[model samples]
Target: MSAIEASPAQQATVRMAARALGRAGLVHAYGHCSLRLNHDYLLVCAPMPPGLIQREAGVVVPIRGELPDGVLGEVRIHQQIYARRNDVGAVARSMPPSVMSLSTAGITPVPRHGPGTYFAPSAPLWDDVQLVRSTPQAEGVAETLGHARAVVMRGNGAVVVGATLEEAVAFTWFLEDAARVECAIRAMRLENASAMSAEDAARRATTAGRVIERMWDYLSAGDLELNSSHA
Candidate 1:
């Protein structure tokens, strides 16, 4: 449903998704996310920083054209993807530190945790370090993304897409976890450090999708739920 037509609950879920991504360390103050409101439009958060996003902060806008005040300049990224990919329902752009680090280093993240299996064997890199503010740039990045779940923007961060909001959030979380593990391995200088095989990753992706809603429930509950689990 379009954000203009979304229920209070749906809009609230969108807000929660954004904040949860922030809490999971997938996004910082600068990045943005969007939900495909309908076939022709997406509901994107305002240009305000990530952690501060509220339910009312979203703006329903067309895929292209002069952006509304407070709309993100990089809404073009969300716009172009929604324009080109018929199956996509949600998109998230984040600047998680580890992911951005790997991007700058020209290293693609691989599955290190079981959740990491949700990603492709290697997330494609956009290579361009500029803000994705133009249609051609957005289309090129979307092309690099292809059918992959995620793509890394060199010197920027990563963008994840999904058939649903839950899946997008799941990918964002797993992407950062993979990056963290990759950085750890690199830090240790393991000459032959191995990542999960593509076959294993595919198998895990299937399993992860089945339980993604549960995982999202746990994650969205914040650290109190996590702390209680360890208590």
Candidate 2:
């Protein structure tokens, strides 16, 4: 396929990932998701709220160039990340409530639980609340992410990347769950709640036995498109 054209299955996967992020409460009206089509392009979902997207709605965007006419401005975040991280096949920009709430305190979730271990020591913090609309701003966000699976934007939400679209979706959920736990710990005043050791977190962070796939299946289970042949 050409860099500008995505097959039906690829388009369906992008739609499914967007909807899953929405249904899981990880995103709302302002978020977007994209999957890399190749080294040169990516397919981003329609600009509307993720949950409200329907049919084959996506635009193929070049990885290194001016944003396409109809693409959202912040999609530059995806473009920048795709340009820097060849390992990342998909990207999600989400506003999970707990993640946003925790980030406001200048904190990213600690590795205090099983799902949290995937992020290990902690997800990096962008320390910026501004929307990443410019190329420079998007580059800053992607640089903050580095080799991490996710990066929390202070009071702005988060950006998650994965080796595949499913892994990206699963990691988005995991990041939020970790933040939820962190919020609960703070609420209970458990300031001493111990975090998993780096050694232990590394051991537990493996993607063995369909760990990520299972989470993706659970999150996308109710999507009719994913259940159909298009999935």
Candidate 3:
């Protein structure tokens, strides 16, 4: 059991990520997010109804095990990712409609905006459409993901990883935006939907760290607004 308990601040970040991603339509009742507590254990959003996730809702789940009550079965996804990537501190499994739609097709999102540049060089598309349930399946996903910030699961959605919960959560939205823009452009049948040049993308990539931080702040505020609206 590699999973361990999360600190109070880490738990708060996990909850915020869930609500922010849900409010942004990047995830729903079916999807989930997680934060690595260390090299072993992870804190994941326990299975629950849709909407905002509060601090108390995060579950400390092991990398491999009989899951605790409320923990999603797909936890292996996070476990395998963390096991494979020493640099990853957070992971998100979101199913945004646009990202899902684009995943099933041959289209790949390029740097179309500042947010899109977070993926910089490019994003990988995982051809498998099957759910990541078992350890082997999750391991497969990690392989496909490689060093990419995110990977589109064919006929599924996407898996995003980052060095922080904030970055990972921001990536969920940024990746969705990229997919949405690509889909919109495809719909228009643009003759020249030019992607950002490598030089420009490289320049933008240099600012990705700060960009994700700001995006996290902005999205967390949006999550608060959604909370207030529901109040």
Candidate 4:
């Protein structure tokens, strides 16, 4: 697949998404986000902490080939995922504190709240603590994600996907909030706390009424780069 150049607007959006994840505390010094340019290529944030990426244009890499020099090793996760999931147009690698803590105990957040419903019954657990730096490992993680919106890596972090970059960022926040609810319930020893029924979750898991757009606005509200652009 031939690489495509990411426009300045696309680069800005990717940077803003990275900053949003960092500002929301969903990621710290080890996370990334990418926007799919098409089936053949994606534009990933610079090889730095997502929060600190400013004025740096993203790297455009082919979805099916070896990662270009200067791309992070873990970016292979994005590569394999884009290769497998055509519906996904963006991907976020985040490590929300609550989500991370819960996954260490082999638990993925259950849909106990409205935000949780976006993940439906629950986010799948990848059950691995290792970083996804190898082709086979990345493929395995993407396979575990399946058609789900997110996947929790055991004691590592998570991967969230969406039809757009903004939606992916919003889902990262939603996943963290769901984890927060689950952690609170478990901490209170609420063994009887009921998770949303499958039917109920299906009903509640919607993007109606600008739910995702509102979140994206909130997260990107103060982003100077994004605010300065008309894209």
For all candidates, what are the clash counts? 0, 0, 4, 0
TM-score per candidate, chains pooled: 0.88, 0.96, 0.87, 0.97
Displacement of the residue 102 alpha carbon in candidate 4, Å: 0.6
lDDT of 2 by residue, 1-231 (tens): 334688888888988998999999999888999999999999999998998888857999999998878789999999999999999999999999999998999999989999899998999999988888799999999999999999999999999999988999999999999999999998999978999999999999989999998998899997868754254
After superposition, the stretches of candidate 3 with alpha carbons farther than 4 Å from their true spots are 1-4, 49-52, 64-70, 222-231
* Residue range 43-124, candidate 3, lDDT tens digits: 8876763345664557887765556665666777788888889899999898888888887884558898766787866678
The parts of candidate 2 lying over 4 Å away from their true place are: 1-3, 227-231
Off by over 4 Å in 1: 1-4, 64-66, 208-210, 222-231
Error of 1 at 114 (Å): 2.1
- The clash tally of candidate 3 reads 4
TM-score of 3: 0.87
Error of 1 at 56 (Å): 2.3
lDDT of 4 by residue, 32-124 (tens): 999999879999999898999888888999998999988999899999999999999999999999999999999988899999999988899
Q: Which is better, 2 or 3, measured by lDDT?
A: 2
Model 1, range 117-137, lDDT digits (tens) per residue? Answer: 777578889998898877789
